[model samples]
Each structure stands twice: as structure tokens, then as C-alpha cells.
Target: MGVRRVAKGVGDLLIETLGEAVAEVILNLVACALLGCLALIACLCWSFSPRLTIAGAGLFSCLLAHGAWHTVRNPPKGRRRGLAALTAVAFTSTAMTALFLLLYATGCDCL
Candidate 1:
């Protein structure tokens, strides 16, 4: 009877751990998707309306910063690779945003 109880408890613990991991994975995926969609929309809007583009880029930067802050605080297991990738993406996006602003400020005819 004691053995059976221990086995049941272990099983419950395993299930709970698995559920939490799954939830984390889903949330990360959703966040990545949202960021990607925002970037795409902002790029598209850049040619149409500078105001809309700025809004989208600002939102994207805020979300990215929040995600990075959380990840740094918690440092999830097996997520180092993901963090590195996100960092690379963040740099590129930031550069692009800066370039857009610079062009706009200069009143570049190319834009």
C-alpha cells in the first residue's frame, strides 16, 4: 500500500511538471508569432503611413524588451539557444527601425 501511494504521488508530480512545461512552450510560441506578425505589419505600413509604422515598431520593441527581461530573470532551462536567436533578431530589427527613422528625418526621396 505504501509503495502504491508513492507511485501515485510520483505520477502526479510528473504530470504536473509536464503540464507546466507545455504551457510555457505554448506561451513562448504565441509570443514569437505575435512579434513576427507585428514586424511584418509594420514593414508593410512603412510605405503607407509613417505614424502607423512607428506605432507598430514601438509596440514591437516594448514586447521584445519585456520578453527579454522575463527570460533573463528566470533563465529557463534549454532556452539558451532561443535567447541567442532572439537577441540576433532584436539587433536587426532595431537597426532597421533606426534606418527608417533616419531616412524619414532626412526626407529621403527614396522612401
Candidate 2:
């Protein structure tokens, strides 16, 4: 009973942390895309910027697009692994953009 309880506790901890990390990675991707849009909005100004937000939605939409393009361009033997990698990298970058935007929105930097 004691060993089983300990094992259960350890399993629970591993699952919780790993699950959170995975979720963070996914959200980070979406957040980065959203944040990039916000930053670009600030830097370029709406008048100067056009179609960029749509284009910069790299976290989700961009990933899918790039993935499709790579798959089509390369015609993967089994699967478009290159697209998957590119999409993942793009997601991470977009997440970075999102985190920055979140900070900007909250004005946490000043604090």
C-alpha cells in the first residue's frame, strides 16, 4: 500500500507538470502570433500596415499554410516531416510574440 501510494503520487506529479508544459507550448504558439500582430500594429501603424496581421498569424494559420506548402512542394514519401518541423518552429516564434504582447497589454514591464 505504501509503495503504491508513492508511485501514484509520482505519476500524478509527472503527468501534471508534463501536461502543463505541453499546454504552455501550444498556447505560447497562439499567443506569439497574437502578440506579433499587436507589436506590428504599434510599430507600423494601421495606415502603414495592411494584410500583415493576416499574414503574421504565424502560430496557427501560418503553420498550417507552411505545412501544406512544404508537403506539396516536396511530396513526402510517407509524410511531410519538414512541414511539421517548420510549423513547430514557427509556432514557438509566434508564442514569443504572444508573450510579449501579453506583457505589453498588462503594462507589467513598468511594474
For candidate 1, what is the TM-score?
0.46
Candidate 1 per-residue C-alpha lDDT over 1-111 given as tens digits, one digit per residue, 9 for 90 to 100:
999999999999999999999976665555555556756876779889999878877877776785556545666575456655576467667666556445433432222
**35: Cα error in model 2, Å:** 1.3
Give the residue spans of candidate 1 off by over 4 A.
51-111
- For all candidates in order, the CA lDDT equals 0.66, 0.63
Model 1 weakest 10-residue run by lDDT: 102-111
Off by over 4 Å in 2: 40-100, 103-111
Collision count for each candidate, in order: 0, 4
Encode model 2's per-residue lDDT on 1-111: one tens digit a residue: 999999999999999999999976666665566656656665675456546644564445867667555544655467535558777566566566556667544433322
TM-scores of all predicted structures = 0.46, 0.38
Residue 74 miss distance in model 2 (angstroms): 62
Which candidate has the top score in TM-score? Answer: 1
